[model samples]
Target: MKSSRIGRIPIPLNNVHVNAGDPFQVTGPLGVLTLTVPSVIKIKLYQTMIKVTPVFSNQRASAIQGTVRTLISNMVAGVTVGFRKVLVLNGVGFRVSIRNNILTLSLGYSHPIIYCVNRNIKLHLISPSELEVFGVDKQLVGQTSADIKRFHPIEPYKGKGIRFINETVNLKERTKKK
Candidate 1:
């Protein structure tokens, strides 16, 4: 059986404590995250490192091993350092504001869009066009960003919409007529 490349990577725990059991729990200063370990993967916790290995030498076992390792790694990182996502709006009359746990967005539409912020996630407005999302869970942070971006996705013609800070939109040229 071919060994898993990602499974071989050792995840070093800084100040986080990992409890290995049916449902693995990782606790740190920021927060605690729990994940269910696959039956085919064996999780071992040490003083300063966590190791994941496959119980059986099979293709499916190897795949689960790698996936479990990554999930555990993200849990550890999330609890320790947390996660953040930034979004920027580009367009005339485009703006974002947060007040009283409610996020209000004006994307050049007839009516304003309001989104209720999740208790686990923190939302901040850096500027009228920039917004930031913070959370201990990577999935939560990413999901919140995607939900907000879906309101006004980037248009191919004008490149006007909400997008991630690192995202780039390739604008299509306008049609020419004789």
Candidate 2:
């Protein structure tokens, strides 16, 4: 038996709606999401309890059932609580600004780079060197961060460029002449 397959997810007061046929609709401060379960899966939502089970004998079916339930639970939590990613610019003249949905970045380049923000994501410039990204979708958030980092990847020599707050750059050692 897969111990991780069995679990309980809490429903936030603002982001969960129970419906028939194991289908549910969840809305939160971030956004809204909907999920449907097949007959082979069983789901029960109490005042604050959510139970998921598989009717089939196959382990794959059980795993799928558990996965679907966990996804739905995460959606509820994400919509209610939202998610955030922070990026720090580490170099001279590396700065960012947002205007009319366009992010203008000056990462020690001769010309400024402009990136159009997607509708599903929110970008904020906390300062010239600090950027904050928010979105309900984790993948989108990560992609945006990567794209930004690509414009000016952190170099090993001086560790100059854009990078995540938690990221560490491996600096290369300078070789001495023989």
Candidate 3:
């Protein structure tokens, strides 16, 4: 069988150095990240590019190789330029602030919610209700954003809560009083 189409597209090393092994290590200006390779996939390093392949030609191997290739690609991009996620709190009396890697959030609750920020992730408060999550690891940045958003997801009635920069939420009308 032909090699996985996505896996054939070599991943550009850019400013990152990749070490292929049981757990691939990607080092760059941002920092270092490691990804444990699957048992059915193989990785080859080159001067300016990295190639991935499947150990077998079966259906599962091909799918795994493609996934591995995309993940490594994201890793390279993550190390080179980094990743960011923007979140907005859209409700009255909702506010957030960061101090010493700790987030004190007031989301209309009786008491503020104190959140401990991740060491690897940088939390930047653009405003009282808007914030940005920055990190070299794409997964970490996204995970942190999701965790914060979970505190108060958007309500269908008011469409108020934490939302990503590009997220779209539909508001529902209130019930009529007879």
Candidate 4:
């Protein structure tokens, strides 16, 4: 049986406090994250490291061992340095504003779209067309970014809409006017 190579990699724990229980918990300066550890994998938390091992030699156990290790690693990182996603709006009258934790977006729509910020996530408007989402949970940060972007996803024709900072949109060429 092939063992998980990723599972063999030792996860280095910084100043995060980990509790080995039914639901593994990790707490750091940023925030606290909890993950349900599988029974097939055994987690050993040391003073400065974390080890994940399979209780039984099997394909499922091996796969789960690596998955659990990665989840735990993400939890630790999330509660420590946290995660962030940046979004950019591209359009003629595209604009964004934040007031009282409410994000107001003007994407050529007759009515401005308002998005309430999640308590766990922090929202920052860098400019009229740029925004940043911050959170300790990587999933929440990503999901929040996606939800906001969905309001005005980039169109292939004009590439006018909300998109990630690093994302590249291929604008469709316009036909020559006869």
For this target, which candidate reaches the highest TM-score against the unseen true structure?
1
Residue runs of model 2 more than 4 Å from their true location after superposition? 1-15, 18-24, 35-42
- For 70-93, candidate 4 gives per-residue lDDT tens digits of 888889999999999999999999
How many angstroms is residue 6 displaced in model 2 relative to the true structure, after the best TM-score fit? 5.6
Ranking by lDDT: 4, 1, 3, 2
Q: Tell me the lDDT of model 4 at 155.
A: 95
lDDT of 3 by residue, 73-157 (tens): 9889988899999999999999999999999989999999998988999999898889999998888898999999999999999
Q: What is the TM-score (0 to 1) of candidate 4?
A: 0.94
The CA lDDT of each predicted structure is: 0.90, 0.76, 0.90, 0.91
RMSD values for the candidates in order, in angstroms, are 1.1, 2.9, 1.3, 1.3
Q: Cα deviation in Å at residue 76, candidate 2?
A: 1.6
TM-score for every candidate vs. truth? 0.95, 0.80, 0.94, 0.94
Q: How accurate is candidate 1 locally (lDDT)?
A: 0.90
- lDDT at residue 31 of model 3 (Cα atoms): 89
Question: Per-residue alpha-carbon lDDT of model 1 for 68-160, expressed as tens digits?
Answer: 888888888998889999999999999998998799999999999999989889888888899999988888899999999999999999899
Candidate 4 segments whose C-alpha is farther than 4 A from its true place: none
Clashes of each: 0, 0, 0, 0
Per-residue error for 98 in candidate 2, Å, reads: 0.4
